[model samples]
Target: MINAINLNSKLEIQAEAFIRFYYEETKKSAQQYKERLSEVAAEIRETGTYTHTKQELTFGAKVAWRNSAKCIGRLFWDSLEVFDERSAKTEEEIAAALLRHIEHATNGGRIRPTLTAFAPQKPEGSDIRIWNHQLIRYAGYRTPDGVVGDPASVELTEAIQRLGWTGQGTKYDVLPLVVQIGSRKPKWFPIPGEAVMEVKFEHPDIEELAGLGLQWYAVPILSDMALNVGGVRYTAAPFNGWYMGTEIGARNLADADRYDELPAIADLLDLDRSTNTTLWKDRALLELNSAVIHSFKTNGVSIVDHHTAAEQFMRFMKREQEQGRDVNARWSWLIPPMSPAATPVWHRNDLTEREIDPDYAPQERPY
Candidate 1:
């Protein structure tokens, strides 16, 4: 139990933080937000909360990406393109906007980090949300033999099927977008082929490995989170960053619960798996990572390896410090899972875990 008074008090605190950050980041005259704050205070007194203006929403989206402590790619946070779609009130409108998001984010193979903040959830209105973890993700199916698709997406895939959509049951099939507006039943929209840009991975050392049929999308657009600007929560804000090579090579493709390609890769490399000292998994992982890097680079796709990503993060921290701002970071997330110790972020103790406002928050899975 929470009471209305307590909730409003918390909202006031969040409002202050967002307004202060907005003024600082945009260098807007303090009087502007002061006047806006008075209006927000009045609104809260009547309705328990207030909404953000288009300008505030845009800047808040960018700063939220900047405050994502777990991201090693925060160096380009300021470059995020923000789309304000707060007026979108229908499932059809949202789905159309999402398609535009996919195409703009794909950027004809050069992915751009983008965020589209839709209408915020209101006390009297239902939330507008995208049920999928991402706007573009491969489908997963649980078959009698075993899982036939991305194991991570099995639950979502089943839910989509139940809603009257079908997949080709292929490993690389792009799932349809599920849009839920207010209290309406969720609707499915097929993503156009031109909106998705996938890169087929091939190893420079092992050219024959290309025949294995492994590939991944260029951008990682996470759509299943709430974007909290001040105390106002936008439930349908989707955002993305250019993928790091390790995210595709080591985690998505190599994680045991996901694609789980390590064993197959080790067999192809002919590494002895009998002894723990042989480090067959490590050898195979390095090859896979190398292949991902080489493939993305050859295709002119924007990607960063763990080492370079860490180095860029360091530069971001320095720049923030020069601007009299402290960098908040979650060490566990800032360091890549594949080679943690080899990166500079692993040895650093200066990182802080302080929570910041205008940030994206993980929400419960809709399915």
Candidate 2:
């Protein structure tokens, strides 16, 4: 009984913290929301709970995206479509909403950045979680010789398997969604194939590359992160954005820890692998980046190259200054991994990390 009382007291504190943060971030007249604030305070006093209005919810979600330090894609932060799914408390309802998210973000190949904000954490209820790293991701499997899939997904793949879900262990196997409702056991839901759009990467110059069978999804929908709107934490808010070519070409496909296809790509080009000075790696990287950009363009999918993306980010910064908003960013992320000197962001030292309200953050994993 004492524990319950302490939990209720903590909830009241959290509610008040969230209220203060929200009012400050939104910059709306407090007098206009006096009645709403009073109602929230009353609910916290009685039931130890509170809710946000749709306007507040939308504004919070957008600002969170804007404050994302690691996202170079914040140039389109205002373009994010926020889907308030606070009512999706059940596992089935959440699964249905995820499907809708996939379909909408795919957007018939012209991917759209979208966010689905679920219920906030409650004192008495369990927090909802999507265990998958992304709504759509390839599975990684542990094998006798070596890892047969994406090494990054190996942990989540095993977790999904523990939840009674299995994948074919192919080079490109879409993993099932592991949805958990509060303290209840997690369940797996298979995504409809039609909702996911993938493009096979083939270099414009290399005709034989198509036979290698490499493809990537049109949108990257990250699902594991928590969305902290003001002080209110939403554990199941999944968000997505259109791909940046280098993210796929340089990191996911080229990284030694990831796909590690650079060696094979170099070999196919018949380049000298005998020494590091041959510039084989550079040549291979260019071809890979070209393949990704060309494939997306051929498939009529929306994708941005690193150079162009950096240029757009400069425009975003200028616009933010005009609006009298501080542009906080992570320099390492704002610069592309493939070619740092080629882009203007490389020379800029203005990017710095700062504490900002309403941001998406990484959650601590249960050990």
The candidate maximizing TM-score is 1
Q: State in Å the error of residue 248, model 2.
A: 0.4
- Clashes by residue pair, model 1: none
Q: Please provide, for model 2 over 1-367, each residue's C-alpha lDDT reduced to its tens digit, 9 standing for 90 to 100.
A: 0011122355555545555556655675666445455667677777666677887788778888888988888889989898999998688899999999999988888888899989988868799989888899989898997787788999888888887888888878888888887768888899878777889999898997777778888889999899876457888899988889999999998899888888888988999999999999999999989999999999999999999999988888888899888888999888998887899999887678897667898986521
Q: Candidate 1, TM-score vs. the true structure?
A: 0.94
Give the alpha-carbon lDDT of every model: 0.86, 0.83
Candidate 2 global CA lDDT score: 0.83
Please provide TM-scores, in order, for all candidate models, with all chains considered together.
Answer: 0.94, 0.92
Error of 1 at 7 (Å): 13
